[model samples]
Target: MKNLVFALFLLPTATVGSAGLAFGEDSRQLATLPPPAQEALREEMRDNLVALNEVLSLMVAGKVKEAGEVAEAKLGVSAMGKHRSKPMDARPGPHMPPAMHGIGMDGHKAASEFAAVAKTGDRDKALALLPNLTSACVACHFSYRIR
Candidate 1:
């Protein structure tokens, strides 16, 4: 059952990859945002990757609480508030497709939930939630492209 669940999650990503290869062009839908907004979004995504790395490092170091703090500060719902304060031209949410926006929101929520679990200082508990947090990102990336 676990293998099946993993395979199901990978199926969309695999399909998208193969389709892109077959078409000799990107097959994902374009997520149309202004250049500034695009830059902002890209930067935010980079930060998210850094934050995830930090969380994993902390977890490996037996600092589950610190990992939770990092997750909350960088990827959770609080990060959404920071996003709102971006310069007008850099606000990506209003410009994104509804589906894309929804996926992003879900990812943030998942991050928040993961942070909450991590706060319990149970690394196993937090690890169990990581896939839920990351799947939102996988779903969106396979479904849309910024360019």
Candidate 2:
């Protein structure tokens, strides 16, 4: 059952790997922000993606707690970005529209949830939550683009 769960998670990530794209975006448009803001957001997201990779690698290696540590520290609410215009939060103060901020916040929430589940060191439970986490990524990408 654990193998089945892990394999199910691996299938889509492997497909994403072979497709040479992140989160299955064949083509996506840039969000119309200033160049600097775009770059800042892009860098932050790139870092987050790298962190996600590390988390997955750790998960595959049976380092579930370590992965959870990384998730809480790097992918949680406060770690998304410290943008100049606005912080990415569920609140209405960010430069991003409420919908965009909501999406970003949801991503953060998913990461936090993953961290919580991973902490238990139950491989099956952690693996089961994998899609919930990745789906947040896919949803964010589809809803907004970085320049």
Candidate 3:
């Protein structure tokens, strides 16, 4: 199962350019705002990511209901909030750093999807989806400055 999870981590890169944008760009843009605003967004995103990790860990351990609850509490809500924050054209300024949008969405999507799978108690399907979730992490790391 661990090996399966690791393999799932590799899936995003295989499908990278298929998605239009780079990873973390949206969050990176958000990060460039005034420190207070940026920190708020960062804290929110960090919390969501932590929840996602916990949910995934639970899923891997076959703790389906608990994982689903965490996903509902964290990733699902966070993704909806993050996704709602701007119009598509709200690009970063010249002074702003490079960013990766795909990863942020991928992580959110993965958590949501994992939650869905956990609700069904299908560990195999949940494990199968792990790669897509991991892809987001890898894509963001590869494309962003992350300051």
Candidate 4:
């Protein structure tokens, strides 16, 4: 089951432009924000990537609880235990388009579900959720451009 899930997870890259997936432009133009705001967005995304790495390591080490905790605390859509993306409306200067915000929120929602499933120690279910969570990332990346 794990192998199957893992295989499906890699299917998009192997499928040569799968129609169900979104393909993003190589370069995306973001709104003109002050240097600080740009930095903040970069930092937020960086932290998210870091947390993802941490969770993956923990899960691989048979630390599903820790992985779930990290996901709930750091990866959830509204997670704010530490660095977090500011609300779109609250951000200074121009913000992401509404569609971008929606996709981001969807990613968060997927993360939240993944964390919840992980907490149950149901490896199969947790593994199943992984693809869904990651698909949100793929979809968002396909649909958005950040410059």
| Model 2 TM-score relative to the real fold | 0.69
Clashes of each: 0, 0, 9, 0
Candidate 1 lDDT tens digits, 86-130: 887789898899977888888888889899999999899998987
The reply for model 2, stretches above 4 Å from the true place, is 1-30, 78-81, 84-93
Ten consecutive residues with minimal summed lDDT in candidate 4?
80-89
Q: Give the per-residue Cα lDDT of candidate 3 at 77.
A: 32
Worst 10 residues of 3 by lDDT: 87-96
lDDT agreement with native, every candidate: 0.82, 0.69, 0.57, 0.66
Model 4 spans > 4 angstroms off: 1-34, 80-94
RMSD of each candidate relative to the true structure: 3.8, 7.6, 8.9, 6.6
Ranking by lDDT: 1, 2, 4, 3
- Candidate 4 residue 45 Cα shift, in angstroms, is 0.9
**Residue pairs of candidate 2 with colliding backbone atoms:** none
Predict model 2's lDDT versus the native.
Answer: 0.69
In terms of lDDT, model 3 sits at 0.57
State how far residue 4 of model 4 sits from its true place (Å): 20
Model 4 residue pairs with clashes: none
Task: Give the per-residue lDDT of model 2 (tens digit) for 1-147.
Answer: 233334445657666776766555546444466555666667777888898899999999999989888988888765654553463432222556666666677778777888899988888888887766666566556546645
Q: Which portions of model 3 miss their true places by more than 4 Å?
A: 1-31, 77-79, 82-99
Best by TM-score: 1
